[model samples]
Target: MGGQTAPLVWGADAEGGAPYVFYHRESGELVGFEVDLARALERRLGRPIVFRQYDFKRLVDGLERGDLDLVMNGLEVTPDRARRVRFTRPYYVFRLQLVVRKGESRCGDLACCVKAAARIGTLENSAASRLLADLGAVALLYDSQVTPFEDLQLGRLDALLLDVPIVRAFLPHWPDLVAVEPPIPGRGFYAIAVRKEDEALAAQLDEALAFLAATGELRAILERWGLWDQGQEELLPPGFSGSLAVSQGSSPPAGASPRRLLTLALLAKAALVTVALSLASMGLAVLTGLGVAVARLYGPGWLQAGALVYVEFFRGVPVLLLLYLLYFGLPAAWAALTGTPGLYISPFWTAVVGLGLTYAAYEAEIYRAALQAIPPTQWEAAASLGLSPKQTFVHVVLPQALRLVLPPSTSDFVALFKDTSLAGTITVVELAKQYQIISTSGADFRVLVEAGLITACLYLFMSVPVGHLARRWERRLASAR
Candidate 1:
């Protein structure tokens, strides 16, 4: 347990996890119902509260890893999750809400939305998603709660399914959106979760929650956020609305075979996404790199300087930062400037352009080094043989440079394959993100282990052949020398 001297650290995705935990842009401070609750709990426990930001899907992982003492970011108590984390008594009860553009007729309720086969969007690992899956709805799963609503506003989605409180938080911002007359059927309870082994901390949290409920503090907190409702009114204890019993661990499904076929299939699909993106981006990088190398080596002085700046700027910045700028920032700026609705780059193309351009900078440097390594006398010799500069580059310089750059290029390809995982931040569902979704959705550690192994094997499969080819080329080049 965290003592008075130590901070009570909780995990949250403040950037995307709004209403639950978020940074107030105007005040430059973290403010939300959960933030307030954490502060109140801190006072009760005689410790400072620390909100550690993480991806919503990774919050539990942070708690399990001991990077966090608890998680309070609207985490629902699910059987799968109960297997991994012992949850405190529920502090809030919420339902799934169906949201659509105001006055939309065809798909308002859950039954109608399912009947119409409308394109719905929801958070990937939420109970809402599993319900949508069971209903056989065509759902676009998003990592960020913000994204699906954004898409809904832009008409990219026919409906948005999310927690009731989340919908309420968002309705004030998007006037065109409206929740259905009633929320969806099932209720989800939010609780602070701790690792199952941490019984002492779990007990502390439960006790604190009990005190908050008894004192009317919890009800005040919920009302302050506009999260108090009739369901909550019926659910709290005497002074409050309601609370659920503490959760025990949920064991794996009884009939689950160790075959892991479905898990492998899911991993294979994601691996294909990784491979396709990598290959396409590599192709673009090679073309751009050749152009950059040519410009730096043979173009005018200003062109050479500009080429150098482009290469250095991209190489200096991290790929993830670059991706964020292009995927979120660039499109937002475009939409703002043009006043265009739904005019944004897809995550797929964003990854392709962002990764291609970033890697091109590195590729350019590789090509430049390889180009420079070739004797200047070779160009002179080609000129003496009546070859033009273009002819010399095509027939002489490029051929030799390609061989020289092969080994490093092969390594870059492998690195890029791994880096595609970064696209998950921008909502590209590559192998690593798929693994996260599947493992957490099932609350099965076995899926995580098997998925990780599959990803590793696939990466190795892709790179080993390239490595062998590079070595063979090295031997050939050495023999020629």
Candidate 2:
């Protein structure tokens, strides 16, 4: 599929699907047979191949929705699947095989083993499961291969069912697994698939595959990892020892940024989420911090003392600790108190409360200083004018106090903006969350640098006008005196 409207392909990380195509999140590189084969085919066809990966069963939905042009995972061209989407002509062929402890390879059926009460584990959607189901055999469906591998090694499962090449690639990493007699009994083929309507693309891919096979490139690529038993005329010597590593945030060779070229929309969504949270947090801080500071400053002694304890406890704690206490712990407590399943507040609102309360301690001190800084003469003058204490505070003390603290208040707003990053630990998709996403999903740690760069730029953008206003307020305070 080469047109602008052409569909993209979806691949799966079938465990031991290793070396055929393994995506290491830390490396961000797509590896193995299908990975390399897809790349080579792009070169052959002179068309770009865009690949998205997920678990195999999940891939079927993308295909049905036309989100995928083809499924490139080592999926069998099964009869049932044929009822759903057209499968290409078979390429590499194999049967479902059972890997058991050495010397116990051939068992008539799981019926004999179950009488002995042995456990067998196979992957969900694997051919081994299909064959076992056909024979009415009992087997465990393992979501990940390592679980079954560990169980079989620890003597929990009697056998592991896997296809031949996967078992082959899987063995060197694990020295103990051995294949026994396979149950499906016949060779099936592995091929890149497209919808039947995509027969044109299939023909184009078939020609490329045939050319690769003829040039001995296919067998050669396999032989490097000892997987080249396909009885071809010639084999290209294995060229490289390993798969490509994906490094997030690291600049690509030159003139290419992963965000721009890979998934710009995902990154932009993260940026917007970050900005929205930061602004909301700052707005709440102004409203709630004023109330918190007033409660601490001028309330009854007991009330002031309690507010003091609240402010001091939060201020003395690390910001990150406060973030968690508010986001997670407080929410749990709220749910318990309310007798509801999910009555906790949102992390954004809670963050504003916690951070606002913490910062309000400093604001309380600022208010106390501002109130005290007003000369007794000024209050006496107001009293001589027949003004009450409330009038004196409102007309004379409060305005000067706000002016005195304008600079620090501005700085505090900036601090709160940056602090919104801690919200990501609760799985909020903020700017910092994007860094973790790109670093883990894109498999590149450079996402940190990328996010940092964007954050610093954003801070400059927001801080400049606010900083200008704070300075202007300072100048006004000087002129007033």
Best by TM-score: 1
TM-score of 1: 0.55
Per-residue lDDT over 356-434 for candidate 2, one digit per residue giving the tens place of the 0 to 100 score: 6666666666666666677789889989999998888789877777876787778887776677777665445565555
Clashes of 1: 5
What shift in Å separates residue 127 of candidate 1 from its native position after superposition?
1.3
Q: Judge candidate 2 against the unseen true structure and give its global Cα lDDT, from 0 to 1.
A: 0.61
Q: What are the models' TM-scores?
A: 0.55, 0.48
Model 1 misses residue 440 by how many Å?
22
Best by lDDT: 1
Kindly give the stretch of ten consecutive residues in candidate 1 with the minimal lDDT sum.
249-258
Alpha carbon deviation, residue 401, candidate 2 (Å): 28
Q: Name the regions of candidate 2 deviating beyond 4 angstroms.
A: 1-8, 14-17, 24-28, 102-117, 181-184, 230-481
The whole-model C-alpha lDDT of candidate 1 against the native structure comes to: 0.76
